[model samples]
Target: MTIHELSPQRSAALTGVIPPVSTPLTPDYEVDTASLTRLVDHLLAGGVDGLFVLGSTSEVAFLPDSHRKIVLDTVTHHVAGQVPVLAGVIDMTALRVLDHARVAVEAGVDGLVATAPFYTRTHPAEIELHFRTIAAQTGLPLYAYDLPVSVHSKLGGDLLLELASDGVLAGVKDSSGDEGALRGVILGRRDRRDIASFSVLTGSELTVETALWMGADGVVPGLGNVDPHGYARLFRAASNGDWEAARAEQERLLQLFELVNVGRPRMGLGSSALGAFKAALYLRGIIDHPTTAVPQIPLNDDEIARVGKYLSASGLL
Candidate 1:
């Protein structure tokens, strides 16, 4: 069922470890459907509650529109509603975002995740209008993807809270890298919102335990592509109030997260991070080929070995 259906089960699907899945590509950089299926199965076996496709980690912007549809159709059909599927509509305008949203809906996603219009100057009013228009046009559960890194616009806690209260948003995926802002939104959701089911998920993998403690609903860690089981365990520990276990898990996961840094010396942040994830997955034998989309520099043999060391240290290998 779509998130708009709002059944008891649907309300609950928005919570827990929903990873922004990495896109697996063939050696020639096509969407590897077989590898994609295996990755989905790997995540399901790892006990993830849901999946967020076409996000930053998924290389949505680098993907041509055709490949984006391939990913949506492949994931949505393969998942078969085992869990809610939230797909990103990352674009530069509301109308352009709506174009992607239509495909997401056609592909059978349960919800839509979008960011503020980017590649141009925008005001808070335009940002709000962007989301409002998408929500009205799509009629799906709309999620605000607050990532200042790519969109270059920070969405404040106040605007998100207002949208949530206004019934234009179903939840938020805050990758804005602002911890204090995240806490403000979580607390506001807890204390001010009339709706009890509005989810507040953080993209900060390292601080997920603390975010949960502060009343955030769940997490969407890109690192989860390599270690979904670890993240799932951490979320459960936090949910059960075992702060000690949560911290231990978070620390271990942070160690695994160090792999992202291994490639930083030679590549841009996105390339290094994305390449490291694919290398880890390839080492784990999850995805057959670890070829990243161009022109993101692919990790060399040396970099892949470094990634293995990080995975080995974190018990991912």
Candidate 2:
């Protein structure tokens, strides 16, 4: 299908939650479609604005292309228009990303969330060209995913505006965690407003309110994989300018994020953020097991105990 006029169809106005959903797997490590479907349905009921499938939390690197297609098709068909769907296209090469975007759109995705090309550090101009090329190829609204720590590209304000002027670049997921950098993008290049507008979304729980105050449209949080309802409420509070309520919810979510995230000293590097999320999911009885693909370890006993205690204290379980 030829696509044009790439305006965002997502809830990109910063008032709801969108979870980077986990890819449920069986004991043999095959993608468990039924479990994944149930998890998606559960989050939808919990009031998530949409689903970001095959995200970093989903271990997209572990799944082969064939498996990715299966998950994408299943999700798009099963969703049946209940909520918008965004497919993660995290690839090391622009050509590979373009192929993934084409297939995802054909499978009926509403939009695409593409990470900067990893495996190499490139100049800002190179990064802009890479994204512009991809956006030009696919008509889907492209969210510039600025996860510098993961993908090694820092999306600057001028570059963001440049991509936006080309029409395919829709908004940004500012996982950079730099409040100043996010604000620059939000305030940068107002002249390009004719092409499309950029919405800044944050990855750090520490800077969500800051991002929202700076005009972020919404969040694509990893923790939302397990705590959709809490995030939904939090987003609503932030949107309505309910600072007190939003602050309280942010504190609660930050606590949960720290307990499971590997960046915390209590957990260490070998830990899987994905596993910690699945552990929380199991506690909630949302999924059957905390399964991971090859080379990714499951959460240990101490980690499980820590998660259980934290969730209990927060009454999330």
Candidate 3:
């Protein structure tokens, strides 16, 4: 149960399409371990370079402590060092995040991903302090997650670079959708001599190709959970300098990404997207159920049909 060696060395750098994997749930909303194992197999079979558990796509914000532990344990145990498993320590504050990070480390994640503290107003200085404290306390490599929509505060490029230079962070998982800022981070790392081996991964699924073209190190596309092969192919094509093939693959994925919107009219954003992913997994027979966590609307039969259409159109069916 203790998988300490999975932690990345100081010099280790993560790259390629790492999916923020979905947490498969049963009808009663328990963490379906069998389904989760199958999901992990599905992604690995599709050739993903790494796996991210407890991320937004995995409904980290909604899961209780027990549920989160089950997810982390299941993923790391099943992965068994095959690929790096980055666990998200998403909570409302530094102390809470540290607690989660400790659990994740004990569970044997290769790295930790965290968003800026949310629910309470936070200043730039507090955000910097937050990461610095976590980095100092936990020896595991840490990646800052920039998700303004959920965290309510954007990680500024200056703050991020400062932390990177000080060795407080290994990289950033940017989902802020700010291309200019993303480019700045990419270029800053390139130009800074003090910052070493910082991996920049874009969480923007739709703009993955552009992010690559802009010199991003990798991608953490949530959609990769649904089609890891497509994202892996896209990453390979881009990394190999085949822009045309990469573009084609990216466009195809963009079309597939439209499934996230199918339930928007009847549910919240998380509900629609997560529901769509689970639905896709179910349709593919990768998971047993498509039920999302409570308080989030589940896709009705009609919405599920829309997901099917997107899958069939994308040749996944």
Whole-structure CA lDDT of model 1: 0.89
- Give me the overall lDDT of model 2: 0.76
Residues 108-217, model 2: lDDT tens digits: 98788897777877877678777777776677778878888777777777777766765657777778877888777767744454533455677765557667767777
Q: For candidate 3, lDDT tens digit of each residue in 1-317? A: 22233333465568899999999988998999999999999999999999999999998878999999999999999999999999999999988988898899889888899899999999999999888878887788889999998788999998998888888889999999899999999988887777758889999998888999998989998899899999999999999999999999999998999999999867778899999999998998999999899899999999998899999999999
TM-score of 2: 0.90
**Stretches of candidate 3 above 4 Å error?**
1-9
RMSD of 2: 2.9
Residue range with the least summed lDDT across 10 consecutive positions in model 3: 1-10
Candidate 1 TM-score, C-alpha based: 0.95
State the lDDT of candidate 1 residue by residue for 1-317, as single tens digits: 22233311224327999999899999998999999999999999999999999999999989999999999999999999999999999999988888898889899998899999999899999999988888877777888899898888999888988888777888899898798999888778776635566788999978999888988889999999999999999999989999999999999998889888777778888899999999999999999998999999999999999999998888777
* Model 3 score (lDDT): 0.90
Question: What shift in Å separates residue 212 of candidate 1 from its native position after superposition?
Answer: 0.8
TM-scores of the models, in the order given: 0.95, 0.90, 0.96
- CA error at residue 168 for candidate 3, angstroms: 0.6
Highest-scoring model, lDDT: 3
Residue 104, candidate 1: C-alpha displacement in angstroms? 0.6
